[model samples]
Every structure is written in structure tokens, then in C-alpha cells.
Target: MLTEARLVAVVVTSAMAGAAPPGVDDDAFLAAMAEDTYELVAGLDSVTPVLVTSMPGMEEIVWPGTPVVEIPDLSGAALVRAAFAALPYGEQAVLLSGDAPDLPALLIGKLFRALGRARLAVCPAADGGAVAIAAHLPFPDWAEVGFDDHDPVGALRASAPAPRTVATGPGWHRLRVPGDIARLDPGLEGWDGTRALLSG
Candidate 1:
């Protein structure tokens, strides 16, 4: 999938900040998210992936191979914009949620291949949000991204020129609440870190 594609997966997220999800506190949430980011970086071995964080000194905790991109304390669209801007222009820039750890390596390849056909592609979450986005170069003004709004997936669709859609199932779900973890299967391959954290 990355043969001639300048693909970079920007794991866009922050440390635990808001209310804790059920069955876990802020610390556990942070750990779980770290594991998620770790696996994502490890899984995408072909394309260089980076973890975008607002927290200082997070590089030591994230997966070793992946690099870290720190922004000046931003959130929502601003944070996403900063992360994307830091990376060199690529044929495809995939913005992924660090909290959604269950994405297997196969799915990551599929998303990149889909981008080859469209200027932009998104794997929409079941809740009208987005779990991942693969956009072709010359990124749009992220301020209009409308993150945390009612329908960010819809917003992205409108911003690009006929953006393509990638199919996703339960495995692609994002971890918002503690119960949302149930959507993942610890037994599955490539999610060892998340499995260990959630199981223990």
C-alpha cells in the first residue's frame, strides 16, 4: 500500500483530561491510550508514523520506534492542524485517533490503498464521527474541521472534493468510554499492549 505513497499516520490525541470513562480513572485511561498509540506505531512499520501529543515528555512512554510531535498546548482542530503541519508533505496523510487501538495492520494498508483513488478518504465512526482519515496533500484549513461537533465525518466529507469512504466494523471503534473497550478483542493479534492493560 505504501509502495509509491508518501504515507504518514499522525496519531492525533492528548493525555487523559476530561471525565474518566466507566471502569477506569484518568491514569488508567492515559495508560490505555498509550498502549493504543504504541501498537499503532508498531503496526505501521512501512510508513513512518508519529504520535502527536500535548503532554510534555511523552516520547519516552510511546512506542520506541515512532517519533513524537509536540504542539503548544492545543486541542480539537488546532491540535490536529499543528500535528499535520509538522510533518513533511506526503502523498497521503492519515489522521488517526490514538485512542482507537484495535486497528489491525491489514486495515491500515487498506485505508492507504483507498486513498490512491481519491483526494481524501475517511473511515467514519458509527456515531457520525471519524475513526481515521487519509487525505491527499495540500491539507485543508483544519479550523473548519469541526472536531467534537455533532458530525465531524460529515464535515470532512463536505470539505474535500468527493472524498471516498472506507468500510469499517467494530474493530475500528474508538475508545471513548470504558465500556467501549468491549468492542475490542484482546485475543486478536497486534493489540498486545492494549490487551494486557485492559485484561489486567
Candidate 2:
């Protein structure tokens, strides 16, 4: 239940947990991704971008004017459940994986738009996992669903109650392994920070 139509982009800034792309360490990779994701949504008039994380010292890396929400490093399904639980009831929100550094603004916009109708909308990653999950504030009890799986879209859909409608958005690439970096488009409007780091 949302207080209004306000859209909030909750970028999950969890530290990079696995392998990073070439020439980029975990910190550099995570920072680049964070910057890319934040900038892509920051320009959106209808959306408010906030960095959500359990990582310590996150404020130091955050953009000066941006807001941050700190949650316990609950580890696993509980972490995301807490992230959404920590959100204000008034904000209709989308939870994005920080690893999808080059995810486009258009897709981010589409998720918010889809939330206008469906109770839940998820953008599946071209690889295995999902890059984004969107829903109204006080997110449904499905936070733990499909999260542990390599391919979560099916589990995410199956876990929803019949009363709630789940929508699937366009699939995108997430930089999970070094190879995923190749999927980043040089012509894309966003991800400049990631591009710079990769090119360096």
C-alpha cells in the first residue's frame, strides 16, 4: 500500500561478492556500478534515487546530495527483506542489484511504469539472475523468493499469490563475471562511470 504515486529507485549497493570485470578490483567495480546506477535514475523527475546497503563506510562513496539507507548485513534473503522493510511506506520502489552497472534508464523507467498496474515487476538478467525487482512499499512477503537461485524469474513468479499480478520487464545484462562486461554497450547514454573505469 503506497501513500502516493512517488517512485523510489532503491539501488542495492552491496559490496561485490564474486568475480569482477577485467582491470577492476571489487571496490572500483562496485563504485563504478553504483555511480552508473545512481546517475541513470537521478535525472528522472518522477523518481527519487537512494543507495541502500549494509556495507560500512558507504556514505564516503555516495554522491554528496544522495540519500542512503543502511540495513544490517542480514546475509541472503533476509538482507533484501530488510532493505525493502526499511523503506518509507509512501514510496513505491524498485530494488536494483548494484552489479548491473550498465543497466539503462529506460528500463528503470519501465519498471516504475509497470508498477502502476502489476503488484510486482522483475527484470530478468540476460545471464542467470534478475537485475531488478519492483513493487509498492511494504513489499509483499515474497522477498525471500527465488533469490537463492541462479535463475530467479520462475521462482519469483511462482512464489506470488494468485491475487497478486507479477509482470516481467525487459531482460538486461549484469556484470556478474568478467565476461559480462563485454555485454556493456559503448553507445549507451548511462554507465559513463563504469565506462571510464573499464577503459582506464
Candidate 3:
């Protein structure tokens, strides 16, 4: 079994590209979403969440106490690859999207637990993509797992062998479109950064 584990959370997000969804100011929304993502990941006591962004000037906005890592202005698998490759090898590294404002902390803990049993752990997004994914270090083929393709999670599932899946509530969704705003829980707690913007 793994011991003295190194857990790194690579929050794969952007403030320039897929940052803006409908019904919100692009820049403001992206910043809020990034903050939400940061709060959610950092809450996991044992995990170190790093803001991996292609957005310039991210340091000025990401929540205090969170680390920021900059990647090339790329998207899809290329972006994922660069972010993952940059992280030093660890026992587990979780890949998440900034759009998942209200991702449950319990689910994130579960991902770490699940990693103990499998080489890969994934939580499927309602839209056939993945809201969060955890992989044993020295992760799998980044090229094979298409990031923004028609079916990102499916491509990832196909590429990784027998990944352990954790059950996450419907709240585990991505805020990518205008309709997605309706899915946000008005009473959401913890992720105050995004909740304040989306709920109001």
C-alpha cells in the first residue's frame, strides 16, 4: 500500500478561454469560479490544491494561501498533459475543472480513498465529462484522453484501465453554459466564492 503519500490537486482551469459561460460577466465569473474551485480543493486537509491556469495574472486573484502554476496557452489534452507533467510524481494527483464550483469535499476525500484501491479514480460529470479525476502518480497517457472532445470522460475511461468510480451527487456539475446556472444550489455552503456570484 502507498505510504507517506504526496497528494497534488491540479485544478485545470482558465480565465481566458473556457472561463466565461453565458449569463455572467466573463472575467468576473472566471475569477469567482477559480476562487470557488480553490476553496473546495483546499478544504481537503491532506491535499495540496494548486491552481493550474493558462490565464495570465492569475496570482493576483487566486485565493490567498493557494499555490499557482502557469501552463502554456493550450487546451484539451495538451493542457492536461502539460499540467500533469509539471507536477512532481506523487502518490495521487487530482485533476479538476474550475467550473465545478460546488464539488463536494466528501467526494474529493473519497477520490483519495478510492485511489488507494485503484490506479485511477474518476467522478463523472452529468454532461458525460468528468467533474474531477484522481490518478496514481506517473499518470496515464495524456494524449489518449481527449480533454474537450465530444466525450472527454469516455475517452479517459477508455484510455485508463479499470478506474475506480466514486458516487457523486448531481450537484457535481460543470458551469459551462447558461442553462447550468439553474443547477447551482441556492443554499450552497462552503464554496462561498462562487455561490455568492451564481446564486445572487
Candidate 4:
């Protein structure tokens, strides 16, 4: 579906220092994300992915051929704008968090399919947050909505005057806090890419 349509998969990563959790090692997280991203791309028959990350020092950790676009920081609206601005125009971009290990490739396709009808399509996190957002149009103004807080979904819904929005059925989980990792399903136990971090 993505091959015929203009689409780009934007994977946003953090700088070396801010790459991982507060206590986890940055290199490990980068490596894990790189692996997971490769798996994500391999699983998809369509969609071209571009890996956009914050500043250097992590180049040695990610997969080869992954484009690394450095940004200032992850907080605030500037980061969102910078990330989107870096993307090539005319293609719908699907923004995926580097840490969302459970991101299903099938769902990614589903998101694009939904985007045909809805201005915005999101996969809500298990923690009442958003794990992914796919947009057919150019990036939306996230500044109008507060992204620093935990619940970006609610913010997007309230702030954006989008004509329509859709979400996938509940099940997706993001690995934010340590406890959040443990909430993953047992089937993912064997996928070390997801298990190492999610399975406490």
C-alpha cells in the first residue's frame, strides 16, 4: 500500500546521553532500537523508513544505512517541528517511538489505511498514552498541544481541530517506566529485541 502511495516511516531516536531510560545504558537502548527497527522494516512489504535521531555519539550503535538526523532535544514543540521538517515532503509520514517494542508491522499498514479517511490515526499506548501517530498531511502543529505531558493522545484530540481521528484496539504498550516494560504479553517473551527491555 505504501509503495503506491507516498509514505515515509520516521523513527525518532534520542541523543546518546538521553537515549535510554534514566538508569539504562544509552548504547544498549540504541542497539535495541536499531534491531527492533530493522525487524519492523523487514516485516513490512511497503513503506520507506527513515531513522531520525538526536545529535551524534550514537552513530556506532544503530544499523548501517539508517539515516540519523540530529535534533536538539526530545521535549518541547521545537523537537516535533524539527523532526517533521527534516522529513521529505509529499509523503505521509508515520512517526514511531524508538522504544515501542511491540509496534506491529501489520498495524502500521492498518494505520495508513485508516489515514485515508481520518486526518489522524493513532495507536494508543496501554498506559493511556499514544504510541504511534500516522498523518497523511504535513506535520501538524504540536505546540498548540502540550506534548511534554504523559497523555499526548488527549492533547492531540483536544488541541487539533482535525475532522476525524481513529485509534487501534487497545493492546499496544510503550516501554516508558520499568513497570511498563513488565506489562508486555508473554508471547513477546522470545523476541529478545522486545523481551530484553520489556521482560523485567
Candidate 5:
């Protein structure tokens, strides 16, 4: 179970400046992220929601009354770094991608439960990057970690301080391209958020 004082920071990064990919809409992606965050929070024992994003235009798209913090001129590693830096201290935060339509709430709970024993925990994506990460310390140097090589696990292993690092199995995947969405398990059919995006 997650500690009561810990905050569940949901990092919702957006690519507002770039043109929407061939089949993906920016609004749908943002909605999916919000839904994923909601699911994780609902299934968890105790959590405080903190939505972090770089898209200034997303305030209109996100859920009403959702507390949001905006970051400026950030992308890739810098974006992740800024998001972590913005989170309030003294609360354990879980960083999850805004584009993961199939993020399992159970898996998120498992990650937090594992964090009680380990220093860091991750849900690895099929494409080699991580869909989610739960850590006690903010990794500001993660900017140098090579995400382009599709070796986030390796990058994190080498860069992250030598502590108890654990992986929460292999069900998590990120939605970077259209093909990535098709690989999700059928269990996602029950998710209103997932159905809305896949139906598009």
C-alpha cells in the first residue's frame, strides 16, 4: 500500500508544438493520459494527484479542476527532468507517460508496493523505453540518458545510482507510433479511455 503522505505525481507531457501524427489527435492523447492517471489513482491505496505538463493549451483539454503545472521550453530528457523537479517534495511520485493507453492500474499499485522495498521500480515498454517509473529521488541527470537508442533500461541502469532496482514484469507499452497501439492486450477493451482512442 502507498503511504498516506506520499503524493502520486502524474506526469502528462504533451507534444503541442509538433504536428499531430498521422492517425493520432493531440486532444485524444491528452484525454487518454488523464484517464490513465485517474485509473491508477482509483486503484491505489492512497494518492494525491499532481498533473505536470509542458503544453499550455492542454488546460482546456484536461479534466475540470485538475491541478496542473506547466513547464516551458522542455523536450525529451529535459522535459522529464523538469517534470520531476516541479513535483512537491516529501511525497513519493510516480512518473508515467501521458500516451500510454494500456497502463494497468494494478501494475501501478504493484510498482508502489515494490518501491517500499526498492529504491527504484520501472514498467518497461516492449520498445525498450519505460512506460512508467517510481522513484524516491528525482533523477535530474536523466537528460543524458539516451532514449533514442531504445535502451532506457540500460541507460537508467548505468546512470541511476546503484540501488535496489526492480522491473514490474512486461505488460507496459508506450504509444509513440500508430503500430504501437495495436499491440495492446484485449483487456484494454474494458477501459473507456482506451476504447475511445482505439475507436478513433
Candidate 6:
């Protein structure tokens, strides 16, 4: 009896839900973010989507059957640690920023593929942060590096004792402020939740 190894993708939505750019409705914005995160991860059939947040009632946002891990500490590595603990069944984990709704599915697929060759992989954000990170179980120290500020990805790479074990995947846009809207491509079909709300 052989069971498939689980690969969990933990989507952190607290950041997106807490901050909405000017002129956007808060509820609509959060709904779009939640919808987009599920939609983006849904495109990757091999991975299971999990919601990790300190905020209560977030479970209602993700698709049914999706697990939610509510942690009191979401700072830096603690966030990853909680996710790692929540999904003990997962042999591998990918931390996804709930904000990158428009990120292509292929880029996320690339992160998992990159992890195949390395212990750690990061999908760099255009803002110098990270949109997603892939790491095998028994997490590496570099995985603890804070994914905040302007250069968390750079910091993660530098923290790696073995640079070769850290891999980089295709970069993508991570929406934060209103100006970030410029990076969104009009042709992308999957981020409909976000695009529809912002279309007006």
C-alpha cells in the first residue's frame, strides 16, 4: 500500500485582507484575493491548498476540503513553522503570498520543479520580496529568513549555508499598493476575480 507524498501549498491571506488599496471595497478586495489564491493554486493539481492565517473565519474563503491553520504567530519563519506543523502529512511545502493573485500557474509549477533539484526554491517577486517558496520537509535554515521588506529573497539566498541548495524560480508580480496595478497583464485569464473587481 503506497500513498503519494503530499505537497502542501500554504496561502497566507492575512496580509492581503488587512490592506486594500485606495478606492477598492474591503470585502470585495478580500474576496478577490481569496478567490484568486484558490484559483491560482487550483491550477496545480498535484499540490493541496491550505489556508494559514491568524484571522478568524478565513476558512469560509477557500474551497471546501481545504485545511486552515490559524496561528497566533505569522512573523518570518514562525509562519512557515506553523504551516509545517499543521500539515504533518506533507512531504514538501510551498509558501504562497495570498496577494499574488495574478501570478501564472506555470511559475508556481516551476517552483516545485526547482525544488526537485534543490532543498529550497523561491519565486522572486518583482518588488525584491518573494511570492512563493518551495522547500522539502525537515525545513532548511534559509527557509526561516524573513519574507518581508524590500529584499527578503536576497536575504534568504544569503542565509543559505550552501548557496547551491537554494534555487530561484521565475519571478512574478506581487501586488501591494495601488501603483502595482500597472504590472497586471490584461490578457491573464485566471485572475478573473481580481481583474473583474478592478476593471471598473
TM-score for each candidate, following the candidate numbering: 0.77, 0.85, 0.80, 0.74, 0.76, 0.86
Candidate 1 vs candidate 6, TM-score winner: 6
Task: Name the TM-score of candidate 2.
Answer: 0.85
Would you list the clashing residue pairs of candidate 3?
A: none
lDDT (CA) per prediction:
0.59, 0.69, 0.64, 0.57, 0.60, 0.71
lDDT of 5 by residue, 88-186 (tens): 664566777666655767777776777787666667777676667776656445334322236665666676556345444344766666566566667
Model 4, span 15-124: residue lDDT tens? 32243555667667656755575456545666665666773564554457645566666654565566667765446766666666556666677777777776666767
Per-residue error (Å), model 1, residue 56: 2.4
What's the ranking of the predictions by TM-score, best on top? 6, 2, 3, 1, 5, 4
Q: Can you give the lDDT of residue 100 in candidate 5?
A: 64
All-Cα superposition RMSD per candidate:
3.6, 2.8, 3.5, 3.8, 3.6, 2.5
Cα lDDT for residue 186, candidate 5: 70
Better of 3 and 4 by TM-score: 3
Q: Which regions of candidate 2 fall more than 4 Å away from where they truly are?
A: 1-5, 13-19, 146-148
Local accuracy of candidate 1 as per-residue lDDT tens digits, 1-200: 45334555545455333324545556555656666655665556667666666665567666665567776766666655666677654566777766666666666666667766665555666455666666666666532452344566557666644545322222266666666666776766665656665566
CA shift at 71, candidate 6, in angstroms?
1.5
After superposing all C-alphas onto the true structure, candidate 2 shows an RMSD in angstroms of 2.8
lDDT of 2 by residue, 40-107 (tens): 76676766667787766666655686668887766455766777777654557887877776677788
Q: Total clashing residue pairs per candidate?
A: 0, 0, 0, 0, 0, 0
Better of 1 and 2 by TM-score: 2
**Candidate 1 pairs with clashing backbones:** none
Worst 10 residues of 3 by lDDT: 162-171
TM-score of candidate 6 on Cα atoms, chains taken together: 0.86
Best by lDDT: 6
The residue-by-residue lDDT of candidate 3 on 1-200, one tens digit each, is 33235455545455233445556677777777767777777666766667777776667655586667777877666766677777644567877877777777787777677766666666666666667666776767542543445565556555554533322223267777666767777666766766666566
Model 4, position 195, has a per-residue lDDT of 56
lDDT of 3 at 32: 77
Q: 28, model 3: CA deviation in Å?
A: 0.8
